[model samples]
Target chain A: MSEFEALDFYLMDELLSDEQRLIRDTVRQFVTEKCLPIIEEHQAAGTFPTDLIGPVAELGMLGANLPEEYGCAGLESSTYGIMMQELERGDSGLRSFVSVQGALCMYPIFEFGSEEQRREWLPRMASGEVIGCFGLTEPDAGSDPGAMRTTAVKDGDDWIINGVKMWITNGTMAKIAIIWAQTDDGIRGFVVPTDLPGFQAIEVKGKYSLRASDTAELVLEDVCVPGDALLPKSGGLRSPLMCLNQARYGIAWGGIGAAQACFDEALRYAKARITFGKPVAQTQLVQELLTEIASEITKAQTLCWRLGELKDAGRARPEQISMAKRNNIEMARNTARRCREILGGNGILDEYQAFRHMVNLESVYTYEGTHQIHTLIVGNALTGLPAFG
Target chain B: MRIAVCMKAVVDSQARIELDGDGNLRQDQLRFEVNEYDLYAVEEAIRLAESDEGHVTVISAGTADAVQGLRKGLAMGAADAIHVDCDPDDLDASGVAAVLAAALHDGGYDLVLAGVESDDLGGSQVGVLLAEALGYASTTLVVGTNEPVDGAMQVRRELEGGEHANVQVQFPAVLTIQSGINEPRYPSLKGIMAAKRKDLAVKGLADLGFDGAPARRVESLGLTIPPPRELARMLEGGAEETAAELVRILREEEKAL
Candidate 1:
């Protein structure tokens, strides 16, 4: 509630160029007032917040982290992270929708699509008229996307795609999908509409994590994409990997939001919950748990602040991101465990949200390259030997 | 219309306030800032300037340290600034108004804007006396504003019990903007650097043909701390019990709600 207090810990905002704090605060207020109030109910109901799309667009969070000429907010990378942090502070699933819409969809198009491609799609995405999802992970080749068997063939003016993508966020509701397939050129990303023939998205149904988001299986069978729909500059596995990097940067900061929430809920509960005629907050064990939670939160916040700096300065590397994403989410998961113990019987119940975080991190822990995969990536960087097979 | 604004340098709201020997807030060592309410007025003047493409000069009468406050106005897009080194202790609403009016008398400005009150001082008589002394139409504590038209400005002034009055003033006018009139924008980083090169005219009391300042000593400064008293018993009970205890204590001892 007090931005001035947050500024003291994460002065990441101070490193911005101009008008960045204003943009950060505007999105912060929106999250605090609008998102936080109804997020729990929506998350519990396991439904995507469709009403949020227009407001998110109005705040320029839809197609943020892009050039201004293409109807984007064109904010600095730190500003984008601040927006993601505020949005995820409400719910990670809600912020994930924007990440998919902006970074996963608009970014590859703006970076690789021809001029006509930019004109046709960016403005609509900016205005929230269109929602999109990325199709890259398969039922088998999630962590190692290069092993995917999806294929696209050149046929006249159209390209035929045949593939299946699993665990696609916003898959069921999206109007378009940035589908990555093995083409003759190499592994490439494509813009495929949901309305195309032989393209279908089936709701994955009971999901233990990110339930509020529309997780689905995106299936393509001879789905004809116009030749121009193929991303012009995106070739090899690096193109789709770059999109993952953008999403991971947001996720790196988002983990702190989840950790902070768990810590705050447990802190409040510990102060109020009484056992043996004394507040649990006064117990040495509970205090120790809280102290650990606070330290991790503060350190992760400091790390992410620098991470945002590296991103804004154009020096952010995948291995550098591998460290934060792996460290912070595990830290968050541990904090969630401490919170669950503090709440005792109340923790498992829906009223406390500690268990939800614990379960959510299990999926978040594995998605966007599994935690072990990231550890290996970092280890490989340290030893100067690629350990990942 | 060319307009001038006079602002005060107060300590930042978030800064911890301590009572000085004078039994007032000790401002030393704290980051001094422009009054929060005045920020909305500055933003309004900027809005006027943007639409009308007119000149706005901000003036503040304090020591050289107060130039920081004036530079804040410049960074908010003021045309220029003026800082007059008037002693903070010697200032009253009317006397400061006289100093300001003397500084801007021949500037050919059509309007003047100021905050209704400063957080440090409860008095809100400056804009009225400034307009009166300069023979300009005056309105105080404006809560809302309408688009400028026909060489006049229309403002909504609060009355007793949540009532409001729509008042219009001709070209030469003064209006004290109420707090929460608008949200002031953060000065762009570029604006702060740009403000450093902006010309800030500093004038002395003699420069205005003013022999000296007006009357003071309405209040005297003293150095004594209040004696500490024993702590009251804080009730720790259910909401209903706490509410009943509060009501009983209010009725029996305070004798008024």
Candidate 2:
């Protein structure tokens, strides 16, 4: 009961199937029992809970929404969204780990890899036997991935890959990496094993946000891979962008989870902590903060739910995902800040989750396409004009 | 071995309980989950079945919401489930026991497991009454159960004053599991999906050939929160003066000196 209970103001459960509800409840219980208890310590120590990988895989969460042929759960997209929401309710770091493994790494292999590659990796990755990471962003290219300096040269039947992928989630722990690079044919993806020569993933330290997650800078110098390493279906940058869209959809749901956590903490603290002869929750100013956050969370829930439906129907566009990610993350950031203020001095401590979520929201807001980049994407869709130079 | 676990869906103990004008719980504002003790029983049953290469069947007697608990049990690897469609408000502990006993009498189960008590009512009578109704040997407050030996099971029972007694019961027995017997596993995603496809048989009280009326019914009088404690008075003076005043108060007022 010390953990935050999810707030469902609009009876959104009515929109979900029974299986989806069961999945959500299952993940919610897992988060409450497993993740909530150890998150603060892990976050403080700046170490991922590596022991959780086995249990998490047992939950069928790694590639839950993918096809069952790949040893996934074969759940609907909305169920996956709910899983992400519950994971983020525990910590953004946990959700980020799942998003990287499922959407960024496994998704490309499922969507663009050859049948042989999928056969070789998907089941193992799904079972947590082999961890995977996605490499797209470089030190110079954060928003503009098309301008990445990473290059791959064809050498007989093998390809020599040379690149430095920055801010890579699961980088240090990944057994294999899905590296997006520029090739003579065009931008392409290569599944390079992390044990290859000249492949080094150095952990990034001194992070104030997402501290429990493993983020690293991947250096690949003269890393060689066979012809089959190249994803056969990857044509251009759109392939990787599609994977980002998948991850961003999960982030959209995850932002709401963080916001809910913040709001729950602030509400609980407001009712319990007394000031001026009464609970702070009774005051109008504090009430305003709670109401605003509650309202925004409800709105974000509706948007994410609709987007999930669209995704399941295969009608959702990247622009739509951009809008949800941009809006919900901003909502989460603002709500986290307000909740921190409502918690007074206690909010600054790691004992309370508001500050942790507030700081983590900053990282979430910046990564997976920043607020400005999403705004431009929406703007281009709205005005029917490419705004990016 | 086919083990049967009896579960119930109860209001979440963590939620603030509010009483209605008629002295009944406010159902609209409350959330429900599988009773805590029942979850332990379900876990123990699943463990027994898994180790013995047997099957588990979870059964619950409650309103429509009880299906949630049954599905949760199924998602935790129960082979199937049965729900006795009866409202808890309409039945006493004996009535529920009768219904469940009737269902399990013909269930062909080797063993029956239930919680020592429910979270809402805290009535520790259902499992024992169920054993009597089904004409089965039963034990309550069972902390642990050893593997089946020659169709008999050895169980460790928690007695008063922190004592434990080991007892052996033959097959077709009942055990009311105590909490903390085992840590229940969360339902895996595949299990959740599988639960959706599993057969959950819903039967009415009459289908079990048991009357819906309770042998004894208890009505709630009212519910109220206990009065808050009085604030402690701070002695605002030097340590010596405060000690002197505190001694005086304890001796003259509190009478503790």
lDDT of 1 by residue, A274-296 (tens): 89999999999989988888888
**Candidate 2 off by > 4 Å:** A1-3, B211-257
Task: Note the clash tally of each candidate.
Answer: 0, 0
Clashing pairs in 1: none
lDDT of 2 by residue, B7-53 (tens): 99999877878878777778777878889898899999999998979
Error of 1 at B239 (Å): 12
The CAPRI class of candidate 1 is incorrect
Question: Model 1 — TM-score against the truth?
Answer: 0.77
Report the lDDT tens digits of candidate 2 across residue range A1-389: 46466778998877877678788878888888888889999999999989889999999999888898899998888889999998998899999999999999999999999999999999999999999999999999999999999999999999999989999999999999999999998999999999999999999999999998999999999999999999999989999999999999999999998998889888998999899999999999999988999999999999999999999999999999999999999999999999999999998998889888988889999999999999999999999999886
The models' CA-based lDDT, in order, is 0.81, 0.91
The prediction achieving the highest lDDT against the true structure is 2
Cα deviation of B139 in candidate 1 (Å)? 2.1
